[model samples]
Target: MGKMKRILYFRHDKIGDFVLAWPALAMLKRALPEASIEVFVTPVVASLAEACPYVDHIILDTGDDKAIRAQIAERNYDGIVMARSQVRTMFLVRGLGVPYVVAPKLHWYQYCYKHRVNIQMGEGEPVWRKGCRLTERLLRDNDIPIPSLPTQYWDLSAERPKWQAFYQKQADSQLVFVHAGTGGSSGSLPTSHFVSLIRQIHEQTEQPCQFVLTYSGEERKLAEEIHQALADTPVNVALAPPLDKLVDFAKSLVAADMFIAGSTGPLHLAGLHDVPTVGFYAARRSAVHVKWQTLSQAHKRLSFTPPPGRRDGRNMALVDVDLAASKVAAFLNQDQGK
Candidate 1:
């Protein structure tokens, strides 16, 4: 309660989850300016947390009980906070015997299970931000300093030139980025849908709307397919670079007139950067996964209401490509008017 000299924050999730946890971290740092904050994150998102200024150290592990126990045993942490509410994470921290531990109570899980919807619309039911709110409440109840909501935190000044370079290579015309990929996950829009959408956007916006096909790793295949499909069209399609150069990629997204993507990490990034985004919602997951916070009021969400029982898959055809292009064009025109 007095001061947390040493603390541990645990988040075993994807890149988007880590990014969402930024708000909580910022609150903690503000409350305990001198506290040495360490994070236990999944290896995939470890680098992102390490990049956070509020985090002093990052413990990269997959939230395994033995690994967590071993890591805690080696460190003399004064407080422990788990952003994730998995049973394994709970037991691991409880076993650590830390003097001050923060986690949601057992009852909060029941509440979450009852009200939560599967945002991914994949295998099981969705989890909502309500769980995160519960976790933050628990931390506050335990006398830990909570952080503010996660917003955009970037050194854009350093990234401007990189973005300009990418933009310069683009055709001398209006450019729109269509992000149809998720972060190495199954809950993404179909490639066919993306290709169809891009083709439609090109026809509607005959101004040679360059298509920035942002993707990574194995997902690059999807981008390539989109390029091949639009080979004859005036639209120019290109894949986003590797993860190490994400700052530049993010900068490019911010500079774009409009972004058309599915509910994913980049959507949140776009929202944070004040980029007008048109998100294609897959279903129940899409409803929950889409960015709830937007720096710009002009952002739009084009959700597809999947048929009942078919809610788990990308079955909805509620948003047509023509509508999406119209929205993007309107958003860009509004920006120009400003």
Candidate 2:
């Protein structure tokens, strides 16, 4: 540590994982204001990182070892940090030959880092909080002063009006955004559960709510299933507009009055927007409420498992639809009063 001039951080993962790393990245930039900080992210989340104020540059992880090495070698970063650890990323750090690298000490790859943050998985902290703590420890070990970091960070000011336009169409009606399709990270409720939830919301809210079913390319059928099933309901299940970019997808969330989903990328995105949300989750230790829950106070998580001890990950449908509907309705009402 002779006052590092440049740093590169890697978090080549999904949108949600990249979002969770925001606090740590912000802290790093705050602590070292003069240092050039760039992020190496997957193509899926590159645009989202581009919107972050903390990141000075965005390096897309092309997954080509030679290309990555060449790109990194050119940067000549003084330090590298892995917000989400991966063996390939470790090798990338090694190949670049960055003088100082920091990462969690949870894996065998700890030997490669000049600084290691000893952390246990599921240590009673949200993943984002864990990321912040890890970055803090890394900086502390290197005698770098820590700076304040926000609990959440997303620059939606430019897009806020754009999203507000979408919501304004509903006027005083509550706009509830629902994502029934799971991103394969955690268990998902059955399509029927979603259909039932929508039906219940319409009844409970007395038709004062509009519903939008957000889905990915692979989840079109699931979305359609709910749409078709609710064909006769007074509430219309509109499909969200085609979202081809992560930044656009995130911007679209600003229009939401409330969001409903399982533990997924969009759910996490809504949390960043401070949207009231309700999520469903499976009842496994790793996927438990505390670990995978949304990081928003105006949110609710309904965790369910068939036998409480079952870990097969097939119990998302077991989440009581009526219970979820009631909670979601309550959350929306709380926002209504404000």
Worst 10 residues of 1 by lDDT: 112-121
After superposing candidate 2 on the true structure, give the runs of residues whose Cα lies further than 4 Å from its correct spot. 95-97, 298-307, 311-313
Score residue 106 of candidate 2 by CA lDDT: 66
Task: Encode model 2's per-residue lDDT on 259-319: one tens digit a residue.
Answer: 8887568888887776776767666657455665565552344343433555545677667
RMSD of each: 5.5, 2.6
RMSD of 1: 5.5
Best of the candidates, lDDT: 2
**TM-score per candidate, chains pooled:** 0.74, 0.89
Pairs clashing in candidate 1? 23-150, 27-147, 117-126, 118-125, 118-126, 119-126, 119-285
- lDDT string for model 1 (40-62, tens) is 88787655676677789888785
